[model samples]
Target: MKHTIIFLFVFVFLQKGGLLAQSDGDNFLNNSVKTEHFELLQEFLSIPNDANYPEQITENINWLSDKFNELEFNTAILETEALPLFFAEKLINENLPTVLFYMHFDGQPVDLSKWDQESPYNPVVKMKKGEGWEKVENPDFKNLKEDWRIFARSASDDKGPIAMFLSALQVLQSQGMSPKFNIKVILDSMEEKGSPVLAPAVADHKSVLASDYLVVFDGPMHDSGLPTLLYGVRGITRLRLEVFGPSKPQHSGHFGNYAPNPVFRTAELLASMKDENGKVIIPGFYDGIEIDENAKKIMEAVPDDERGIRKRAGFAKPEQVGGNYQESIQYPSLSVLGIQSGWVGKETRTIVPDKVIVEMDIRTVPETNSNRLIELVRNHIEGQGFTVLD
Candidate 1:
């Protein structure tokens, strides 16, 4: 009797429109989902091509074009010096405002050995909460696992999002929800490399790329999956320093005191750049960097935990930023990535080297130009009596 009741309840639940129901508020973005569409995503992720694999990259682009054609959308491959970009569009309500969805087809280089599945390019299926499966990896829920998570090079960092978008469109079509707005999808191949070629591509294709607004679907979601919307992103600048003194290496025992080791001099020069408390000694660095009131308000809105963040990050206490994690995320920071000079291995290490190279990167916020920052750093080094060598 209990089994009969359970079966009846399940039947009634499935009868109430089942999994294919679309209400008035149902829109293409959230209302529809298709299993075949998602399987296509798995297939798409199976293509393995990094910046090095030109032939495979072309094949993947062509495959994407065929998929767009199957969806009855116009597709084109925009070519650049590097890999080709795939652009697909379906023009609905010809005069309505168009929103271009930005995505990248290329993925980060991956370590094959560390991959859980056979190949990162072999796309797999992992479901979250039932229905049809999604691509996100889950250690807890392992119900309907398939060899579908594309174990390829560019799987999650980007290709996952692209697949999700297409899968959503496929679902909408299945639910008889043809798009209402002018929809476009841009899949770039060079985004992983700081988008060195995007500016030119955007310029050359400005007419076609013109839109009411641009939506970038990248970066990780906040720890809380509350649908974060960002207005801007920070800029970055890198400085490379090379110090040269003596022409060649000399035995430390013979010329240790006489020869000026470039490594030591480089250390002294770097010391002159910053203080123990993390205040940059460079002049005019903070000249135009007055944080705006809006930025301050945004920073304040972020939650703060005086001690909790430190504990979570395995730190003892607060840092030089004089605040919590939220505030630190809002402020600018300087860090030394690496410094290299002479011997590194188990080789006998009693020689003074002639040259030393220090590489550092700075993350900059708004109103800062890369060229100006470079000039300021160069001037600061020149003021320290060291000849600024290229």
Candidate 2:
């Protein structure tokens, strides 16, 4: 699987951090193990692991517990406020450093109407032929094709990686190989639904979950189709700026220009927040983020096809942020997720909206504090001659 390649880089990187044992991923992922891994993935995909349903989540936990138990990992169902977290650890020696692996067993709920297949859980192995996927008959297990995809819910989003990790353990077990460091695996039960119980659980079980490093094993895919090492992920902060106008919706035809539209006020406020080159104009938004020469060299090392990316995205020019795509994300980003002033489409309204609501999600980097960025936004809005209510 493509995700396996991504984990290769992750494993190698974690090895440096003493998270994983010193073993090349290439040597571990043999042909037979990969075949078995695919088989195991099919079984895992068979379980309907939508966290929305308690019963399904129970099944997923049981399956994971059984697998971990089989692998000789001491299994424990760690209790939490919500669904209990599944924990398994193998302590090789007391002196060795502990490396905790963070993984999510729960997947997003699937709508039957969206899939062409009989069921989302029932996976299909298909290969692209003339731009259309054609199911293979008696697929070659000896040599799995990299281009071939296993169509299933959470196949790549997360579950595939879990299967891959389990397969790696199986290979290691078969060869009587043991890691030097103490290994711990924490499987989150409610990660898909924003991990509501995680913080409380972590706080409560600090000693048990404590480790030298936390290795997260989740993501869709890297565009490069190569194992890319990401230094960090941008944290999120939400802001809903409500523009106040008349208490009730006024008749546009009657009031016309006389009635001040909250929509216009909101639009102008949003427009002032960003420049024409897609940079946030709010003071202190990009403060403290000073990319140095070393950062520039690291950014330049990423082999990105800038022209190809532009062609695929159907754009002519790139944003004038930090030279390239990899560099641009290094700075905090401001994105307007959604904005609503009045009803549209079939429910079109012909009146000036009473108030306008704009939702914005700011992607914060380690260089910037979320509170400072929010304060800057509030100050910027106030400077635009508008009263911000919280």
| Clash-forming residue pairs, model 2 | none
- Kindly report which residue stretches of model 1 are placed more than 4 angstroms away from their true locations once superposed: 1-42, 110-155, 245-279, 292-297, 303-319, 329-359
Q: What lDDT tens digits, residue by residue, belong to model 2 across residues 20-109? A: 445455454334345566788889999998988889989988999899999989998888877888899988899988899988988888
Model 2 / residue 275 / CA error / Å: 1.4
- Against the hidden true structure, what lDDT does model 2 obtain? 0.80
Candidate 1 lDDT over residue span 161-203, tens digit each:
6766665555456556554467788888867666667778888
**Candidate 2's TM-score:** 0.81
Maximum-TM-score candidate: 2
Model 2, stretches more than 4 Å misplaced?
2-29, 49-55, 79-83, 108-119, 129-140, 192-196, 220-223, 242-264, 310-317, 340-357
TM-score of every prediction relative to native? 0.72, 0.81
Question: How far off is residue 144 in model 2, in Å?
Answer: 2.2
Q: Could you list the CA RMSD of all candidates, in the order they appear?
A: 8.3, 4.1
